[model samples]
Target: MHKINVHLLGHMSQCETQESSHDSKSKDFRQSDSYSVNETNHTKAPISSTGGTNNKTVPQTSEQETEKRIIRRSPWIDTSSSESNSIHHVVPIKTSDTCPKENTEESIIADLPLPDLPPEPPTELSDSFKELPPINYGQSNSSLGGIGDCNAYNAINSKKRSLEDNETEIKVSRDTWNTKNMRSLEPPRSKKRIHLIAAVKAVKSIKPIRTTLRYDEAITYNKDIKEKEKYIEAYHKEVNQLLKMKTWDTDKYYDRKEIDPKRVINSMFIFNRKRDGTHKARFVARGDIQHPDTYDSGMQSNTVHHYALMTSLSLALDNNYYITQLDISSAYLYADIKEELYIRPPPHLGMNDKLIRLKKSLYGLKQSGANWYETIKSYLIKQCGMEEVRGWSCVFKNSQVTICLFVDDMVLFSKNLNSNKRIIDKLKMQYDTKIINLGESDEEIQYDILGLEIKYQRGKYMKLGMENSLTEKIPKLNVPLNPKGRKLSAPGQPGLYIDQQELELEEDDYKMKVHEMQKLIGLASYVGYKFRFDLLYYINTLAQHILFPSKQVLDMTYELIQFIWNTRDKQLIWHKSKPVKPTNKLVVISDASYGNQPYYKSQIGNIYLLNGKVIGGKSTKASLTCTSTTEAEIHAISESVPLLNNLSYLIQELDKKPITKGLLTDSKSTISIIISNNEEKFRNRFFGTKAMRLRDEVSGNHLHVCYIETKKNIADVMTKPLPIKTFKLLTNKWIH
Candidate 1:
């Protein structure tokens, strides 16, 4: 047993460490000789016999038993030899580095290069040798590789040189016999015979079911559904009129290319961001007929051009009244087509399909705009009994309420005297319109009003927001890394470049960092909280660790989500209410991330409040160009005007009025721009024009834009990430 253990261990160690020995080889030789002696174990079943022992000892057998007894008593010694049966101990292999050549050969042969065996078969058959009946077979196991070898290996490794030489002789003889057999069995082909066979098969085939037409007789079909018939006839007559006039082509055809049918439709509805707080739908044609520079022809001349028009319409309506917006179901379908147009039907429709003669205005046609405008005008003026307002084609009125129209979009105000049902009934009778009632579903529709995201909120009809969306609907305005012309150097080394090109890559990186910081601080400020400067830096570091590559945007979004989750339990509330005074008015505090280039645009930070409720706020970059602090403030003021106006309308819409409105700018010159209104002009025409417009609008509504001392304004939180003391002060005023 000790020898066996040493042998197994030595086998494994020899393979691993290359140890060799002579005694191990001798032992292997002895084991192999034992395998040859066991032919019965390979070829036959075992033979069994029973015997009983004597009272004192085991019973002795006859000649066969005596020989077995001698074999058992002296297993290693040859029983045929006359030598005495002396037991010789089996010695263990030498544990030395240098092994004898004989031992090495025996050891290697014992560790045979055999392929791995499949799972073990039934083991009931004994491995020991015994006697059994013999049967003769041609494919003997010993003649082959060994017992249990797969036949597939013989086929793969066969080396029969004579088989390749007879290949051509076999093919010629086989082909000649096959040709003779085919000629004897088959008939010759003929054109007449083939045609006769095909005709018989065709006659025996099953026929498809025939379909009956629903409108074989137009007069009878019309009688069956009178209203539908009337509509069809009216449409046909309208189409005939359009056929007599002149129009452009509007039909689309695809040969074999893939197309997104919905994308083509949606693109038409999401063109520009407008100010009107209404359900708006915009469209732009393919303009494939024009050059790239001439694509302006695709613009719809009749759609509401700006948000100011929408706001003005809202302002003209009464306070006690509710404004309801109605969208025309297929608005273009109702417009009378006063032009002749032809459209080749779609590819799959049919080659011989007749073109659809235009009955109503459709997209992509030149005459469609004028026809739609004229149709809407006639309907509102003649059919609806609306009084057309002078100098405004879209604005219309009856004695009870005013209807403001921008092409197909109309806002109907229900005056204090008239009930809501009356206005709805009147509009329904004239045209097909869908009323978008607030709070219908949880899904939100986002649109930009003063560049703030307005979503439908409960208690009030809508709420204004300043948070960036997890996803943007329009492709993000590809914010350039650095747009200004300033030369930026790498980090750690001021004048060095990241690579040989000296791309100013580090400055681009810094610009992004500053932008991210600005956004974070903006959120804190907008919500009336002051983030710790170190906390901001720590957050930035955490951001770095999480986002070493292009994942920074995603990391920032996650951190923001975390921030929102952590702070969700509380909201900003004033600890104490100050008395109503001229100096204690709501103020907009301003700051900027300056001395940084090439993103040298000014940052606009603002917060507006009424009755201590922070009604509207924002922290963002100014879109307009500016060279100085005064210009920056003027730009910020222009950027903030629409928000302030929206807030005022919201207050009025909700019926809350405040005593005074003020704009807080640190720069006195910006205050001068506000105070002068139009009297003083600046070098940059952008500020002067926008400032005058803001002044005129504010003054017309009796609101004021004043510059307070910087310490008093709560909007300072927007400029940059602040230290603990200043952050706390700003947050304390806006948030309790």
Candidate 2:
């Protein structure tokens, strides 16, 4: 039998009683081999079963036999051999770091399903190898005195290379397990040692918290360290702003009872530069957003040129009026959060294991802006005696002044300086105010906003004047290609760029490319909508290809860019265009080309004129398909009536009475059919429903339906592609 030092702490009495009975016989034993003496008198596994017993003991009862376990060896390190076991180590499984430290051996072992043991195990032992006792895998290294100090752990895991062949487990002689040499288990230094099963390395040794960066990013004017300093400064600045806003009460939520980890939202500081050449750091909360089930509402940017024309008209109407733009600082924070929400403290802010409950709306949150707008809307409509413009809640006015809310941007109009003071003071009490720009031009018109310049060619007549620096971005194109022939997902045309190698298209990368193309298409569309109305048709056709643009489609986009560059000199001409008649009102020319799209739908064209100049126009698809030119034109007319009525209402809101306007159309047949007294012509139910809506607008809004020659119609340029001569004549005579 081998000499085994048993660090027995909790179960000493059972082993001592069994060994005292076997001590009378003499036995031979080795010195170095370690083994376990069973504390319970159950299925006892001898260290070397071939060794003979000095005395033949009586068999134990079935209950003790059934309860017998523990393979007479330490579960953490190999002890059956003089050297380390080259085979598997009998150790408990490792667990996640987040596992609680207070778990017991039984608690930990209960989770592991009993693994299937192989049956061919009698080569080394005869029915003696015992079952393993449960070992807690969560034990700390400090609690277990150097379990990894074993030779197996110290070695380079090179047991295979060191041996010429695989080591086999060998049976020993009968004298190896002489029963007289077996001693009783001794009491350990502490009771805790026996319960401590498997000791893994400490949590600190597993993962380290990284404080410094591994690499630095390059910047133009600042070094990596300097940029980091700026970022830290910006981070602190944002923290201060949040503190000032009373966004969260940290002291209240610091209690663990009040804040649950599952309920806590996450927040972080975001850094960016502004369009006005300034740095800004904003803190945002990542609250789990529930789907909005309330009434739909939105914020809108008041058109700059439209506002400019209105401001000029205001000046023309009353020279004493003043125009200015104002903004609210941290507008989103003014509204309180209506739901129960909590935000975790930002990492690296040193907030000690705490989360913050959100009290106010936060920037970059999904629905914060909408809530803030609602909050402000309530204040303006209820408290300020202001009425929203027809079809536009963003533009609010009373008898004193007009207030336009473009998110944070506000353009205020007043009759005098005192009125402007009252308006500013009233808004200042409700919000943190910043005056972006304020002035009134008595002589030469000075129009400047949105980094865009405006050229006043004549009285109240203006054009968008882009800066030389801005135009420098667009290279001059003498010969631009037309984009009429390309299709979006057309199959297998030879591309300038190959896709097999050097240009493999990953799905994600392809989607990103398509998104970039879509953004460019949007930029082109906006420019067309605001200034270059001539390019509207071209942009709409290209926009249809945004989802699955092929190489040819991309080529078409490049051609459109070049074409825009070629006609960059063309500008949006905004001026007062109402005729000098007894009843001053608008004249809208509307038309439609049926089946102009691939979807068998019509393209709508609308042109509204006021004070003998172009005020508003659109080249877009009709909302519904129309089988006839008359239905198409009528749909086109239905779309324009709302816009014309809105314009007339704006003028009327300015204390000017706008009477009935003329809606001119080139389709005389369509005009004659609508004016007919026969209601039977419109009784197709669905068609009749749409026709009745049109009929109601024609009579209800007091609009005159007139017809003109197709050649003379100003809206004809938008319906289809025209010859260069006719397009030039139209541009020179009317559109320009």
Candidate 3:
């Protein structure tokens, strides 16, 4: 008979090594007890020797010995048993000790808690449990929600799977967390419910939950919120009423009160009809009339597009400088028609069926835009000695300087300080020029016109801050930067009536409209500072006409004027006791938009200064007809490139720092075509040559082309009447 005794920690247990020992124990304990304990120990020794070494060297540290015993006993221990036979392997730190300790079956059995037992007669026991397999780490527990099905016994003994596989399984499980819960990860559609839940959850999650707000804070929040609501309510009401009152009679045709046939023929190259009664009938200019510069019997087209280019160029060049835009109140009234054409009398003013004779140019005349361009170009070039750019017909020249005219607006760029001042002063004398003098030169005004707002500081203008209060008034205009309003005036004002009143209107209707107009101007006036209106003056044939007099327009103008007035009062403060280094670079943006007619187009002209002066810029339509917007813009840019080259040369000649020039356009396709040297064929003979030439210029000039959003394109305003908001935004780029 044989017995095995083991001590693990403190508890002791005993198992019979031989069947004879188990049989004897099973018989009478009294008979087994008769056997000597020394005899049982001696009998067990032979069985232990048959298995492994009995000279077990126990570790001095109980923890270390326990781990060693578990590792050694792992194979023999039944992993399926209630007690887990797991071992945590620890890498031993490298050291220079060379003593190796022996591990034996007896040592494992001794380490296990076991009581001494008497040996009995031989009895056979099944050894099937010794063949149990080790388990992988992942298979260890179904209670832990493992992917593969695993029994408790196998799971307890399993070794862990590799890290990569473990992570994959974890990801799958986490991905399905929301689906398993049948609830969305995002908030539900009902925001109110979600908010309620969020509030409740927030309270629960707060480190130190606060169930109520302080009494004073609650009262203050309520009062403040109420006041804010009241202000918003008042603002909405006033704005809505004014907007509702703004109506125009688009169906009715309006006629001018006076008609001079000779002026009409000379300006429009069209005839007029006589009235049945007296000559009191108003004359309306025929927009489709032919002119020497615009329409011809052979070509049959007008050169208004040329004026658009000139306007854009001028505005772009004078962004930061004073831009005194002037309108010849009754521009055609000054030019008598040379030809004699006939037309029907005005529907409203005419008596019996009498036709009107020759007359002055009116608002709707087709050749009116061209005539205005011709008049201004002649004055600037012929009188001022300003030479026009050859390839681009939009440019004109003054002595040692150049003046670009876009109908009512003009931009002046000079070669030297003397020339620049001389040109500015001369133009001021010719037109009703209101020199803002916001900055050092005319280029500053062009920059501001390109959507930069200018603020005067110490005899110079700085770009106004975008966040100024004037920006708040932008959205009121019903038009984009290109004034696209069908109704120029509300129902009360009748006919194609142009208000040329120099005296301020006191009535609410007129005042309200003016206020609105001023809002746009105000917004445009802001650039790097608040807007000022003190310097704002009306430029019209009529001593009274402020072009933008509608409440919406006036509001915009007032704000802008105020911005200017306030800005002029300010002085620049340089805390650093050294002269600041100035950037010597030039930026120009050019773009174009097609008109209501497919053949007609508008152009955007822009230019920027690095060291605060006009470097280069031109916004103009293509001389030849373009098949697409891309082609037209490319032509404009091509024309601008040469101007820039000349400008750079001029700057160098002026003994100024070398300027790094840049060309910007809003058309991605045009930029791509120019950069990649892809030229589009134009069906129109006039535009085809220029289109190809433009592509060549863009490639040859090494022009730095960039794409800009329309909102930021300073040329936009030059091409069209901008809505108050867009106008205001664009105004900041050039006017400070």
Candidate 4:
């Protein structure tokens, strides 16, 4: 038995010496051999069972049994033998009896017979392997198992390769293998990690708060000392202005029983920074809390429509009319309020517990705008001898001049500067009016009204833009690194389409994100609706996702905002291409993109032009789904009729002549459906009613439906995402 144990030990020692010699030849050989062993754990290989060179497949031992065999070996034994052996006899050593006092690899190797040494190694092999660091087998318990455990073998090989110059070779192999089985090998990522990565990559910089501050926030905010003082001073100025205007009856204190506390409502100061670097504090009542029964709902004030403003500007530019802008100071204060209302003064005003009765229409009252509108309407029509246009109540005109009023801001168009001055003098006499722009001649007119910058070159062109609108709202963000580790220098340009997906966010976080997204979209919507028609479609598309915005939606919105900020200088210019006559026709270009929205709803786009100048347009989602492109086109035409009718009425009222209205569409089928008189031909279609109404308009000569090629339709930009070239062509070249 002793001789048999010695023989087995000698065999193991010989195998270990041969493996050590082979490993010393090349580091590449060690890596390849370790990989082969790992592969052979689950596959057939051409390794002999006796650890000799052989080309035969052997049945491998189970990994569990192999691990047990390795654990049972002596600590100093070489467990990295490439061959598997089964023990027939047991020779257990007791610590107190057969075991040596010192258990070490040198002692074990000395007990066994010495095997014949190999020939001297080559100089290249000696130099390459000599400097290779030895593996630290004592670092972990699992390392004792050595090559018996394929995982341990690979780990050790990885450690050794990391210390060597062949790291690139090992990395290449690992990357290749990982690429083939990446999905299986990758561990599941936590939701937090995913969100963190997305947030880090999405925004380049934080957007600064540019919104108005509430009264409390304004007073308490001390970040900027100058700004804080300005806010306080502005508040004082607002209080003084209200007192001078006698907005409320401060002389008499109203008892709580006299008026319902709810009806009395609350008031606060809204602080804002104006464009010219002046701080403005507006004292507004809490009109939102006012009961509906407190005021007449039917008396709601109407502001001038965008279409009317554009039409008037187009007319003024075409006819070389003198243009000027007027700003009414405390215009709402001049109007009386029929309803008895009360409001609390700001805390700092020292009117503790005393409620002031409202005598005039104060800003923030529900009916303030309507009351102011009526006052101005009465003064312009009865006092100034100007007649209100038939359709637009905010627009007043006479034989010599036309006036467009939006809230407190007003635009006057006159045949001469004297006529404009006459109206301005009358306005200044009745109410405090500031002339924002007084055009001295017909050659040039520049002014800003309702945030729109208007530049009119008489008989040449009228350009309308909302400059600094986006730049002032959106802030610079940090650009994220791409996969290649490079920063993107150019501004992001998003398409008109949004692909929404379910986002991974907690309910509260999601709601907060959604609120932020809505505010951003609101800013975009204002610019898109006012003059930047090129962004209308994109804004509409993004607005649809506000209910369930995700990281992708936020990122895309930032991109859209960035694009708008970069291209804010571009304006909507109306070139004078033809003479303006009383009989000139109102042209309408309509388009639709079918099944583009979620739930198969279509997109409707329309452009209203008068004498080759754009007056107004709309880009919105269809209310109902349309099954076909022709149906979508018909839907767009039907939807645009109301606006078109209003525009035509305003133009005819201005010109004092019956004007012809024409509808241009890219779809011949839609035109055919509108012009078709056969009732049975469209009986199967559900749009028969709309088609018949349109046909009546056509037959009655109120509208002329004509076919325009798709490429020539400027409204195409409003329906779908177009190539940048086509978008520029339609918006910059064709529209102008």
Candidate 2 vs. true structure, TM-score: 0.58
Q: Assess every candidate by TM-score.
A: 0.37, 0.58, 0.30, 0.68
Against the unseen true structure, what C-alpha lDDT does each candidate score? 0.35, 0.48, 0.34, 0.59
Clashes of each: 6, 8, 161, 4
C-alpha RMSD of candidate 2? 36.9
Instruction: Give the Å error, residue 251, model 3.
Output: 32
Against the correct fold, how does model 1 do in TM-score?
Answer: 0.37
For residue 21, model 3's alpha carbon misses the true position, in angstroms, by 82
What ranking of all candidate models by lDDT puts the best one first?
4, 2, 1, 3
Best TM-score goes to which candidate? 4
Q: Write candidate 3's Cα lDDT for 143-215 as tens digits.
A: 1010111222222322233346323322323123224444334533321111111211222110221222332
Which segments of model 2 are wrong by more than 4 Å?
A: 1-237, 253-263, 286-321, 351-353, 381-385, 443-459, 464-509, 566-570, 576-584, 678-689, 723-725, 731-736
Which candidate ranks first by lDDT, i.e. highest?
Answer: 4
Cα lDDT tens digits, model 1, 482-574, are 223222110010111111111112333434433443444344332332212112322322222221112232233333333333333332232
Q: How many backbone clashes does candidate 4 have?
A: 4
Off by over 4 Å in 3: 1-283, 286-327, 336-339, 344-352, 391-394, 410-459, 464-584, 587-659, 662-699, 702-736
Candidate 4 or 2, higher TM-score: 4
List candidate 1 stretches off by more than 4 Å.
1-320, 323-325, 337-340, 346-348, 352-354, 364-374, 381-411, 415-420, 438-599, 605-628, 638-662, 672-705, 708-736
Per residue, candidate 4 scores C-alpha lDDT tens digits across 1-736 of 0011111001112122122211111122222222122213324332221121111123354675344333221112112221232111111111222223343212212111111222322221123222333333322111100111122223333233232322222122323323543433344333221232133124332233346789778878557888899999998888888889888787778666666776776888888888667899998888878988788888878898888988888777666777888899888999999997788877786775778888889888889999999888989988899998886879998998888998998988877889989998998888989988887755666677788877877778777877665455555222111323322211222121232222455444555565666677777777877887767877776665565455555665665665665567778877665533334457777887654454446678997777666677788878886655556777888888888888877877776654556676655455545544456545345667767776665555456555543444678667765444344546665223
* TM-score pick, better of 1 and 4: 4
